[model samples]
Target: MTRPPLAVIAGTGFYDLEALEDRVEESIDTRWGPARVTRGSWHGLPVVFLTRHGPGHSVPPHLVNYRANIRALADLGCEDVLAVNVTGSIDPGLVPGDLLCLDDFLDLTRQRPLTFFDGSGPEGVVHVDVTTPYHPALRRELLEAAVAAGHPLRDGGVYAAFEGPRFETAAEIRLARLAGGDVAGMTGVPEVVLAREAGLRYAAVALVVNPCTGVGDSEEPITMEDIEAVLATSREAVLAVLDELVHTRATFTEEGTG
Candidate 1:
């Protein structure tokens, strides 16, 4: 009955962690709101797992309550938060099925709430530094785990976050690359920022689900079918990395990047 100090925040289609022992649902309340989190143990290590998109993939990206999720984990004493993002490949080399440990990000989301401080924080005018938004030590630990688990993981990439229930346009894809984005995804921005502000060591591993609006093998426009197919093919890779990370805790330290 020991509580796991690690938190894994993944997408909906990826559900490998459901197999954890003694898994139970818990309602976590935060200053922003409440978040539903799953508590479980893997290899005797406690893990708190939650999907960025809710069960059955019903929740849209822009609608995700990033603050509540991060706050809930922080309140639960989770020190390391690992986010598994499904991204569109902007780099040709980072094609579908490839896993990349993100090093940076570009926020193009205009509609989502970007911070936890809006005169409602514990301290007034709280300024959290995000010079290195993603924690390096944690990323290195995940990269090592991915390789050890037999998954070929790219060491680094920049994930661009788009405000979307809808996918980005081809023109936007072009703009993403110009802005130094290696891949694009709907989630990853506010979640990451919130985690940093919450004092949790955060890292993300991206599974390239498809090309951005116009960067893949197909000359035709990207569709839901294409992404679905990519996801189907990537299910195993996703399962492997996640299982390995949880079982081993990916060699992450509780001290974090402080």
Candidate 2:
């Protein structure tokens, strides 16, 4: 039996892929808690979608159940995950309209469990290697898809994950950039970590929605709604890249069977 090709975990303002067909909203229970998953077909590819926040976008970054989300998908026989995250740019040129293929991450999250091995879930502590944080093959597919779609996607960048319901300060942004952070966001840390632990091929497509606090005019305050609105600008690119990745996988699967 062939399992589904991929599952998407949408972040922040991205709730679900609206182009999905033959969809059903599923409620899944894991060791962590209840999570809602959208089971459907997108571009004729069997896929599942899960919103990181909730149906209402109420869960804050610190409070999100990363364990349950990944666990549910893995339990459902899903082997690969595409995480769509909205981020702030740390680089000078990567403005609000660019997309980044996240290859590495600097996790600055405080109090979030960095690993699934708490000496209880699995024997001892299974130290999974994160030398290559993002799956290289998956990143390549995403990049090819983005370029083919005529979208400007940075081939590789380091994501700095912040534990936030609040945006970073100027000093923090500066420090982040100095530490090799190309993009900054709230939830990339443990999600990437746990996905590696789950042995699932995972990759992230980061959409830059605004300049980091210090990179641009640091004093100007931005609303969450304002950040969300920027996603609309790259909405087509995001959808197209996702389609390309899924369709590309489906094509390979078909060829291998033939």
- On lDDT, the leading prediction is 2
- Tens digits of per-residue lDDT, candidate 2, 1-258, equal 475647899887788788789999998998878778999887667888999998678899888999988888888888889998889999988888788899999988889877778888647778788999899988888999887777878889999999998999889989998899999999988999999988899999999998888787566776788787887777678888888877777787778777
Clashes of each: 1, 0
lDDT of 1 at 216: 64
Q: Which stretches of candidate 1 lie over 4 Å from their true place?
A: 1-4, 249-258
lDDT tens digits, residue span 54-116, model 1: 777878999999999999999988999988898888887777788889989999999898898
In model 1, pairs of residues that clash are 4-46
Model 1 score (lDDT): 0.83
Give me the candidate number with maximum TM-score.
2
